[model samples]
Target: MAETNLQVLLRRRPKGAPVPEDFEIVETPVPVPAEGEVLVRHQYLSLDPYMRGRMSEAKSYAKPVALGSVMEGRTAGVVVASKAPGFAPGDSVAGGFGWQRFSCVTPAGLIKVDPQEAPLSANLGVLGMPGLTAWVGLEDIGQPKAGETVVVSAASGAVGQVVGQIAKIRGCKVIGIAGGPEKCRFVEEELGFDACIDHRGDLNAQLDKACPEGIDVYWENVGGPVQAAVFPRLRDFARMVMCGVIAQYNVVEGADSFGGPPGPYLGAVVRKRLRIQGFIVSDHGWPRYPQFRREMLGWMADGRMSWREDVVEGLRNAPEAFIGLLQGRNFGKLVVKID
Candidate 1:
């Protein structure tokens, strides 16, 4: 076992988009497990858009990452030492282990995973939180019906890919909005979205062409001009599943600038009788997780769903990779492979 634990700490809050200097990487002694605690050695760390919100002091659903503390993140790992029952060395697990190579956690904090069922890294992606987020948001909120148009923004991303595929399964005409031609191609040709518009292009015109019938359900992931374009296209009685807004995450201004004022859309909401509900996945809890896992695994087995990961080679590169993710440079779910 390595003697030292490598960690990425929040050095300072970013005024806007996060930079490398905002994080501090340091080596410290690997933590020892106490009674009822297990020491885990992380293999892969998940980087997500929500972490950007955590990096700021602004109020949100969750607390901010304290200064000088390890940056908050989820990881898939193996147990190296255990003082907890039902957990032994070599057992695969997934949990909020932050951006560190090792963590000492209680059994309740970890979910044991089977390598035979899926790749250990997958527990942090498609079959994990991202998958759950997509499932809950689309099923509970979007409530898509067959032949209805379902549009997903950030279509090539971790949650968006799953959202579009599931919408397809539910018999919706799924259109995706992604950045660049390559990502749009992956969303359409690979993931089977009906069509994908490149946000870098004329978003409004392309959306008009793709969603000519007007959007019945809009799964929002990017909330800037993309949201603006989709908002005006929502059909009567349409449902809008409000998820993340990556485009606004880096705004240096106050919270009012986050989603750009909803005032203009208020008249449309009442006129169209639209349903817009923002959600955080953890709010739904683990009760529905078994249902999500069962349906998602079945979809994967039947070849109805697919996923991709943009993996960074080492822990040291996470900050750069994460910055690239926010800039839309990553083509898929971004994860850091710890070495």
Candidate 2:
């Protein structure tokens, strides 16, 4: 068992975008598990867009973290000890174990994994949260049909990649919108998107070219300008799943330069009879996780699905990696590898 634990704590709240100094690495003795709990030695830590919302003192569906807590994240780890029944030492597990080298938590929040089946870090990306987010939002809410055009923003990221591939499997003509040519190429070539437009290019023209059929289903992972561009192109009876707003994640806390509320597109929503729904993945559809896991894992095993990870080497680099995530710096899943 590990003798000590190290953690990345929030040193100062970010004003706009985060910087490395906003997090502090601290060392302490490893914790012991309580009843029904196991001690985990974290190996891979997930960096997600949702963490940006947690950094601020703003009100949201999830509670904000206090000023000096270890930054919150979902991680995959190995159980070094267990007081919890059914949890054995050396069991690989996934849970909200935070940004730490060690964790002690109840079995309620942790799920065991078999490493021989897949890469362990994949639990933090393709077969885990990002995968579940994409699957639920697209399959349940978007309900895309065959022969329709399915569009996804942040097209090269973990969630977007899987979402696009799944759409392809369902026979949708898939279009992906990513920030650059490299990412766009990956989406088209590697992930089998029908067309991948560079959002950083002349977005309007590119989108117009890509989705000549109009957008039948839009899996929204980006807000701001991308949303604006997509709005004008939605087809009649289109469906939209609002997942995240990476574009606005970096806007400074208390910045008044932000624009006013959007004008009513009530006419478009009504006339087109579009179905638009915003969802936080965990809260909305986790009850179906078993089904999602079975299907996605099989897809992955059969090489019918693909994924990518932008892994930073150590725990100390998480802040910079997270900062990059808000700015579209990561090409896919962002993970801090601790082991």
Candidate 3:
């Protein structure tokens, strides 16, 4: 048996915001699993905007973490010990194992993975939640037609990047909205988007310049200014997939993160018979994991898709990196290497 040193809860119920001091690190004797359980040593920890909701005491998609509980996160790791029949000592798995160096997991929540095919870290990025989010949100909700104009916000980040590239593969004209000129260049030159507009620039003017035919499908990522800019240009009978609203995540109530008053453009949804749907990407009650894996893997193998990761070196940096992600500080998928 190996000794486990872990990061554990110090306190909960964060004030207006969270800081690193809110977390406490402690070491305790590794507990042995009684039955039907496995012990895993974490290799990579996923830090997402959704975690911010967990830090606060709020009703959300899931229950809030209790005080003195391990911080919740999804991780890819190696199984060090197992009492389960099928899982062995050396199997690799991904699960909601939280922000710790090691975790005791039940087979119910763990997913077996093969690292030999793709990089194991991909289990947390393009091949994981982000990938699935892009796939289903675009396919089922957006329903992008060939030759249609597709717009994606946060266009260089994990989800938006894949969404744009996949839209391009489907023969749609892909326009990406991202912060800064460098990210815009990466989206256009490297990712093969038809056009890339820098949101940090004059957004309305730039989008107007890029989207002459109007937006047929809008993949919403950052919701504040970008959404405002894109809304006016939506074509008749357009579709919108509301994904993440990272720009407004930190805004408190009455702060007007949506900018001034609502624009006159939303009336187009009713006038033009548009379709707009918000989704939370957990297969939307359709466990299409098998189909998603097949199509995405095929695209990856054929180089029809690409992915990037903003890998933070340690867990200590997760807070700042996550803050940066909200501000569009990260250029790709953000993850913490915690092994």
Candidate 4:
């Protein structure tokens, strides 16, 4: 174990898009675990669009990270020391330890991960939260059925990829809305999505061609122009799972960012009898966890499911990586590898 732990702290709030100056990297002595606590050494930190919301002081489902405090994120790490049951030194675990190289916290919330089952970092991604986010949202709210047309925005992203792939597994015709052609190709060829449209191009034209039958299930992730394009294409009785709006995460509150106003979609919703529900991954039903694990794990082991990650080295570069993520620069799940 190292004598010190390097941490990334929120130096100041950003006005629009985040800059490196908004974060300050500092080193502190490694903390020791107290009774019932375990010491963790983070190997990889998960970066998602949701972190942008946590950077602001605005009221939300979760509390904002306090100024001068470590930024919030889930981490996959190895235990350095433990004073808690069900954990021991060298045990691999995943937990909400925020942005830091090492941490000491109560083991109550720690999730034990078997490295033999999957790569350690995957616990922060596909085999974990991102996968669960896709599973619960699509299964619970979207309720897609065979031969239905499902469109997933941010198609190549952490959550979007899983949503599209799962919809495919359920026999749905999956159309992915990705940023670039490269991502679109991967979404179609690699993930088995039926079709993929580049959101940067003319989404309306491409979406019209891709889903000629109209969208039955819309997984709304990049909620901006993409949402606007998708609205007019929704079929009657369509279901929309309101996920993250990455396109507007950086925009200053109260100003038009990327999406259109609610006024435009109101009449369409009532006329079409559409069902729209917003959800957070944390609010996923506990009853479905076992099913998610059994099915997703089995799918991965049998080569029916796959995943990708865009790894950025060093904890200090997290801010830049996160900024790139919001711009749709990352082709897959984004994570910071801290040494």
- Best-performing candidate as measured by lDDT: 1
Model 3: CA > 4 A from native = 1-3, 8-10, 13-17, 253-255, 259-266, 283-286
- Predicted candidate 3: what Cα RMSD to the true structure? 2.1
lDDT of 4 by residue, 1-339 (tens): 657889999999888898889999999999988898999999999998888988898789999899999999999999989898888999999989999999998876788888998998887778778889999998789999999999999989899889988898899999999988899899989999988999889888898799888999999997878888898999999999998888888888767756456786898889999999999888884457667877888989988788989999999889899889988888899999987
| Model 2 Cα lDDT, one tens digit per residue, 1-339 | 746798989888788888888888888999988888899999999999999888888778888877789999999989999998999999999988799999899998788999997888999999889999999888778998899999999999989999999999899999999988899889988998888988878989988888877999999898888888998799999998989877887787565343666555666898899898998887855788789989998999888899999998888788888988988899899899985
> lDDT of candidate 1?
0.92
Model 1 TM-score (2 dp): 0.97
What is candidate 4's TM-score against the reference? 0.97
lDDT of 3 at 83: 92
Clashing residue pairs in candidate 4 (N, C-alpha, C atoms within 3 angstroms): none
Model 3: per-residue Cα lDDT at residue 307: 88
* Displacement of the residue 163 alpha carbon in candidate 2, Å: 0.8
TM-score of each: 0.97, 0.96, 0.93, 0.97
What TM-score does prediction 3 earn? 0.93
Model 2: lDDT equals 0.88
lDDT of 4 at 193: 92
Cα lDDT listed for each candidate: 0.92, 0.88, 0.82, 0.89
Model 3 lDDT per residue over 1-339, tens place? 766667646365555446667676676677677598998888898878777777776556778877788888889989898998789988999988887887787898788989886887888888888888999898889998899999999899989989999999999999998888899989998899998998878988888788988999999987877887888789999998988787776666446547764446656778888898888977472388768877988999999988888898876666677667766778788888985
Clashing pairs in 3: none
